[model samples]
Target: MTANSLELNPVATIQSPFKSRFGIPRQSGLVPDAIGWIEPHAPWHRAEAWAGIEQYTHLWLIWQVHDRPHQPVSSVRPPRLGGNARLGVFATRSPARPNPLGLSLVRLLAMEHQAGQVRIRVGGLDLLDGTPIIDIKPHIAFTDCPPNSHSGFAQNEPERLRVDWSMLPHDEALRLNDHQRLVITQTLSLDPRPAFHDDPERVYGCPLFEFDVQFRVENGTLFVLGLNPFP
Candidate 1:
């Protein structure tokens, strides 16, 4: 193993629906409909290397944190400041700096070419299931579109967390489908949690299959009372 000590592996591996990473939403297209897939590995699953990548709509993951745990930080303590502020891990994105490498842009919801393998069904992912794909650039809206990008020092922009679909459960609104009921009502109206972890007598829970919807967030909105569906 010496081609400069080769070992970069993961050509692809994210299949997210975010099975864990506790309430994911740390940033990444902010849940335009959190869904994911990208399983290319093995001879790069050639199909001419996924020619034209479906006329791009967005794609630029370069993931690899495989579940962190390699610590040796440069500075980090940003759970959006609930971790007691202490930035400087290249100004925060902190997966524990020095190369935990994770950058997303997502949203290209289709592309499968099995038989030589190649799948890619992304959508605003925040990465969490398997995560490993170490490169897949494409989002080039004119050199990474930045028509006035500047949020240095993280200028405040948090205010959206109101979701009350009449306290859900008219048979769970007939099992959603209008884009998953508008992405679960805009992901619980953006209260993905993390402003010092707001807690109005907390009660958040999220799992839906055998049911477990019990949410709560008062004032900033997000209240779905009823339906433990047996959990």
Candidate 2:
């Protein structure tokens, strides 16, 4: 048997508030307030390259799930299924695939065209900070959304956990700006804890933006413990 392989270079990189792998909404748009910036590499960073891109409201991002292990696999346990059942790798959006590539559809918020570079601000991203973006394309609804689509076992989104900020101080919560607060609230509502574990007493910490957002879960409720500066 013969083998063929191809190489690809990252076209851009993203700057996201998801400082670590923990707590990123499992799926894009789950946290509409979660934001990120995409900047092209040297050859393509020129403003002229991004001409007319602002007209579109959404985009498709093809990137590398750079932080996770991607050893070849035939099946993966989906978190949405409580990680109990195994599904073929092709059927799941797990990063542990042969290629470790990720595809996301995100909303484009704004575009900044500087003298030499183009900065694109996008929202509803579910990726790690500094993720390598392999490709970017405008999402054309007419072609991207096919008629009568079926989502299989992942048809509907998982139920969100109710976030309780009572455990956190009013002054501490007040310190965060509107966008920051929204990001924290929306991110925690997705319940980023490991799907296999449901220990109510377990304390978890997620590094979001400039602070360490810590919390716990109990009875379908998520309680924010505190927000400490990143040391």
Candidate 3:
């Protein structure tokens, strides 16, 4: 650390369907239906600071890894490598870093003023609810697009899992709105399983919007069994 290192304060808090990190997509923009918002704090909430922000269609969010509070290790086992092979921390986006920072590119959906607060709705975020956002910047297509970018060991996108909502009961199915339904389906289809485990009978639950969704994987298919109100 340098003597001149500066401190940073959260400019906003994110409101997203992912209450827990268990089911969130590994990267941003993978779940197009996953919606989220940023509620600016205090001075940042002033409308003048956000004037003309709506003109941009996408933004880059620099945020804290709120869930990764433990000390960072020099290397990590990436899930893409079957949790066996190790890689330097800098080479992987493992969330456990020396500074514990995260970056995401999300599409701006809307900007709203409710009462005295400023809310910016966004789509394609993989962030957890209440995550602290440190900064937001417009994504400039002319400068941000790089022709030399490469995926490294992650040569291709992971195969999507098959989600079968047939097991979901009528009463439970009725609880989800169209948006929530799409979010859940898209999220589950990504097979949020840890790369190390593939227990076919293990039931998992994750918070989606206002509901606690329960499901299991069987024969390579994710089955939505039920849902309960998020507590």
Candidate 4:
């Protein structure tokens, strides 16, 4: 088939909590709690076919790079090195590419139909809100899970940032469930930032709900001053 004939139009779009790409996790599986929904176009809304999809733990999402504005290229600068180092586009998960496609393996929560419209509730999405979706596929553990995967050039486990959760108010701490609490703690601990941008004096902020969490890491621990819920 010719290139023009192989072009695939989006069948759906994802509505996610992620309004901006700034704070999204570099990888999807890293944030299993983040939720989103997929709304399929009119032509493909057959509720019966998607029935029992909640029985599965995860689903594979084939989505388009709606946020990518530049032309696709064969090489890119990975964020890991503060975008100073160049690597083959295929080696890194850069959004800019020939196809501008994104593949994410996310947890399926539920499916809802309204007015003949089918929506899929999912978790651990890295895409921004209204991201165009090309297709959906089931994630088979037996076939998709590769136990002996190698990292190749992406070796060297990065060090985690330290966080002091004890400083949080009792009421605020109690508001989060065990899973949310753990995820929040773990995510902050990773200190997801450019490797070369680490500076002791630098402070970072992450918007959570109505608050902006300002923190810094020192001595392998993250220190939280207080919460500033954004307006």
Q: Best candidate, lDDT-wise?
A: 2
lDDT of 3 at 103: 96
lDDT by residue for model 4 (1-231), tens: 695758788888988655556556677866677777888886777787577777789999998888858598888887766678889998988888788788999998888887756788998877777899898889999889888878655555545676798777777666667765555565666675555665766777765444466677666778765566554
Whichever of 1 and 2 has more lDDT, that candidate is: 2
Worst 10 residues of 4 by lDDT: 151-160
TM-score of each: 0.35, 0.95, 0.94, 0.77
lDDT of 1 by residue, 43-126 (tens): 777878889989998889888876859685888777656678787788888677676687888889898886766788988788
- The backbone clash count of each candidate, in order, is 0, 0, 0, 6
Clashing pairs in 2: none
- Could you arrange the candidates by lDDT from highest to lowest? 2, 3, 4, 1
Q: Which lDDT value does model 1 have at 150? A: 83
Order the candidates by TM-score, highest first — what do you get? Answer: 2, 3, 4, 1
Instruction: Report the poorest 10 consecutive residues by lDDT, candidate 2.
Output: 1-10
TM for candidate 4 is 0.77
* Candidate 1 Cα misplacement greater than 4 A, ranges: 1-10, 13-34, 41-62, 65-73, 80-93, 102-113, 116-125, 128-162, 166-179, 182-186, 193-220, 223-231
Q: Model 3: clashing residue pairs?
A: none
Question: Residue by residue across 78-166, what tens digits does model 3's lDDT show?
Answer: 98888999999999998988887999999999999866668899999899999999999999988998777788998688788899999
Instruction: State candidate 3's TM-score.
Output: 0.94
**True-vs-predicted CA distance for residue 141, candidate 3, Å:** 1.1
Q: Which pairs clash inside model 4?
A: 162-221, 162-222, 163-222, 210-229, 211-229, 212-228
